[model samples]
Target: MRTAYSVETVRAAERELMDRLPDGALMRRAAAGLAATAVRMLGWVYGARVLLLVGGGDNGGDALLAGALLARRGAAVTAVLLSPDRAHPGGLAALRAAGGSAGPAAAVSGRALVADLVLDGITGIGGSGGLRPEAAELLARLEARRPGAAEPAVLAVDLPSGVDADTGEVPGAAVRATATATFGAYKPGLLVDPGRQRAGTVRLVDIGLGPHLPPQPDLLALQHSDVARLLPLPSPESDKYRRGVVGVAAGSARYPGAAVLAVGGALRGGAGAVRYAGHAAEGVVAAHPETLVSGGAPREAGRVQSWVVGPGLGTGAEAERAVAQVLEADVPVLVDADGLRFLDPGQVRARRAPTLLTPHAGEAAALLDVAREAVESERLVSVRELARRYGATVLLKGSTTLVASGGRPVRVNPTGTGWLATAGSGDVLSGLAGSLLAAGLDALDAASVGAYLHGLAARLAPEPCTAVEVAAALPSAWQQVRATAGTD
Candidate 1:
């Protein structure tokens, strides 16, 4: 798993490491790593022209020292100080001694400077709100001077300039880096977006802060091997009953295709049998003859290990009854789509069994009675809030799918694409996750694994594929995950 720490945690770890090391030892370690990264990016450091946006804090000091190292390698380096008087004295002296040029921010005045790479050390982890007026204008000027593929590559020092390291929030204008070389460990902002979007390709530079850090992370992202281990596997002695059955209370007279899609996703989700109960049972049976189809209400759906409710169940009283029946079941339940609309928060909060609520930004906004923009902008908070409010695992689905289970670190899904936003995708996810729940995976594992598979399938799609196609590609995605895991 790739883990992320909050700014406070990172600072504490850094302080601990610094206390044990000699004077200037930590900065030297950071500068060496930063310089090595720059050298690799520059290819031929001997003739490369490097530009540094030096700041007042350690972030700028690190970049300045890196510039000095590059100058020793015959690179033409220039340090443009945002705060001339407040710059790091040791770093400044090193740059000057190495024959690198240094000047005030005004030196960039009305001039188009060309460089092989631009290092953004304007601000770091402690920065809050947005970019300062002077820095913002300077970056704007630099951006205007260089545009498109022809522009110099930008590498941010530590956290990107103008991003909240703790929240991953880009309050205002921020530097969009070509890549970022983060020191010690990953910051929360470097993983979550809109800060994530600003940080291009993030590379962690070890400065030996691991031993001083906390045991747990603020956020976690699962890798393929982790997912492989979490997925419920059937053994030679596994029977249909032992494997478990998933009940799907989805679709209606208006949209029977939802039932078909959900059933499709569930069948491929490692479930023993898929028991579908709804008005669209006929359509579902026609699509998949193997499904145990029944008419109306979850109580009549026979025995099921888990239930996937909502998808296209509509907003009628019958729909409300269906949600009530499924919630009343003494098994794990996944609430999604139309099911999310009619759920009673009191009932959900009072449930003894696990409940997973999968909601997009719009649905989440309606539930919280906040604007859609608010939920979308603060996804990490929104997901965690939803989980806390309802006392159930909440999967806030969007650009970055997040699964938060109360006090646990929110799991940020890394394998997703814009194409996964197609219609019926969430329904497929609900069914798949529900199947995993029936197969005995916990709410978090089911949601995270289902989301990972869903995203991977979309990425593997050759072209613009529909939700059905995405579901159809699941077996291949499952095999692919297992295959990769085996190698490890």
Candidate 2:
């Protein structure tokens, strides 16, 4: 799993490493990594003009040492000191000793000042708010010099200046970086939004701080290896019944494709058998000949290890009845799409079996009785709150899909692409998750593994693929998972 540490955790880890290492050793390692990345970004270091925006902290120390390395490699490096007197003394001396020059922050203007790259070291984890007025003015002036002339590639040190390192919030103006060279471990801000958007491509530079980290990370994303271990694999002695069956109640005459997509996903998700009970039975049978069509109510649909309800299910009495029946079942239930609209947290909390709720930002907002923007603003807190309110697993779908169960650490699915946002996507997701649930995975693991596979499948599919294409790509995603399991 790809784990993210909070700012406080990173600081503690750094302290442990610093106690054993010589003075300035960690900074040198971080700076060397940064310099190597800069060389690769600029193609050739010789004669390349580089600009460093220096601040008053260790962040500036990183940039100054990197400038020293670049100068030794024949690059024309200059540091624009925003706080000259308070700058890292050792770093400034190193740069000067290596033939790099320093200039007033206000001097960054005109064609003569254009640079091949700009390193933002204005702030670090200690930064609380936006850029200072002087820093902002200097950036504006530098930006104005280029006037959309393919502005100098920006590389943020640790994080983009002005972004909250812990919350990913851009309280005010923040620099946009083409890449970010971070020290220690990945920060929560680097994976979350505002900061995520600012951080284009992230590169982690190890400063030997991993030994001090806690076993449970603050945030985590399931990788292929984690999914492989968690996914249910049928044994040679297992029968069809032992493998598990998933029952789905989804779609209406108005939205028949939803049923087909959901069943399609279940079939590829390792379910031994799939039972369909809904108004769109014909559509399910026609689209997937293997699906067992049930003409009775969901509660009467023989037996199933897990149930997937909602997904294009229309509102009103009929949809409500189906939801109630799923809740009454002894098996785990995955509620999604339209089913979310009729759900009551009180009823969900009373259920004995595990429940997983998959909702987009809008549906999540409705469940919480808040604006859509409110849930989007703080997704980590929002998903956790939903899980606590219903006593179930809640998966909030978006750019960084978050999955949280009652009092558990939130798992973010990092494999998804924007292309997965097509029609009937959530229906496929719910079916896949329900199949995992039937295979004996817990609610949280089922939701996270299902999301990880669904996203990887989307990315593995050919570009411009439809929902059907995503379902077809599941086997490849599963194969990739198994391939990585041994290594992990």
Candidate 3:
């Protein structure tokens, strides 16, 4: 898994390392990595024009020391000190000794676009709120210089200026970086939205602080290796009954395709048997012959290890009845789509079995009785809130899919392309997740693994693939997961 630590965790780790190392060792280590990245970004350091937007803290120190290194290598490096009084004296001395010059912040106006690179050292983990007035003015001037001109490659030290280091929320104004060279570890802000969009390609510089950190991560992205371990594998003695059965209660006469898509996803998912219990059983059987068709409610449906409710289940009496039946089932339940719309947190809480809710922004908004925009704005908070309210795991889908169980750290799915946002996608996700739940994975693991596979399948598909294609791609996705198990 790709783990992200909070700014507080990173600061603590840095502090521990600082206590052990020599006085200026950490800054030098960070600067050396920053200089190397700048060199790679510019292709050649010699004769290149570089501009550094120096701030007041160690963030500026990193940029100054890196500028000094580039200056010594024949690059024309200039530091525009935003706070000259608090600038790192050691770094400034190093730069002057290496032939780099310091200039006023106003020097950025005309020459910024001509420079090969712009190092944004305006803020770091210690910073709060938006950019200071002077820094904001300089950025505005730089932004106005070019619409689509080939300007300098903007690189940020620690984080892009103006982004919240802790929450990843770009409150007012933030710098748009082409690349960010962060020290120690990945921050939560870099993994979450708004802030994630501003932070382009993120590079982590090993300043030897990894060992001082805690085991629990604030945010995590499942990689192929994580998926491989979490994925259910069958043994030689496994049978349809032994492996696990998934029961799906989805679709209506109005939307038969949802049943087909859900069953399609279930067939490809790692389930021993898939039972379809709804009005659309014929459609499910027609699409997937392997699925055992049952024309009744989920409660009366034959034995199933897990149940998936929702997905094209239209609102009204029938949908509510289906939802009610699934809630009372003995096995784990995954609720999605229209089911999420008709859900009651009290009813979900009363259930004896584990329940998982998968809702895109709209469904999540409906569940919370809040605006869809609110859920999107604070995705982590929204997911956790929903999980706490329903006493079940909640997966909020978007650019960064967040899965949160009550009191557990949220798991963010960083896999998948924008193509996964197409119609009927949630149905496929629900089916796959339900199958994993049937295979005995906990609510969080089922949701996270399913999302990871769903994304990997979309990525593997020819771009612009439909939901059916995503469902069809699950087998290959699982195969890829198993193939990379030991290697990762």
Question: lDDT winner among the candidates?
Answer: 1
> Which residue ranges in model 2 land beyond 4 Å of their true spot?
142-150, 484-488
Against the hidden true structure, what lDDT does model 3 obtain? 0.88
- Residue by residue across 1-488, what tens digits does model 2's lDDT show? 77888889889888888899999899999999999889988999999989899999999999999999999999998899999988999999999999998866766446545899999998888898889999888777777864467678999999999888876777777888999999878887788775788998998888777888888888887776778789899999988778899999998878888988998888877778899999899888988999988867898777999999998888978988999999989899999998998888899999999999999999999999999988876777788889999999999998888899876667888887888989988888899999999888999999999999999999999888789999989899999889877785
- lDDT (tens digit, per residue) of candidate 3 on 162-233: 988766777677899999999988887887787888889998899998899898888888888888888888
TM-score of every candidate = 0.97, 0.94, 0.96
**TM-score (C-alpha) between model 2 and the true structure:** 0.94
Deviation from native of the Cα of residue 39 in model 2, angstroms:
2.3
| Clashing residue pairs for model 2 | none
The residue-by-residue lDDT of candidate 1 on 298-373, one tens digit each, is: 9998999999999999999999999999999999999999999887788898999999999999999999989998
Considering TM-score, which of the candidate structures 2 and 3 is the better prediction for this target?
3
Clashing pairs in 1: none
* CA error at residue 243 for candidate 1, angstroms: 0.8
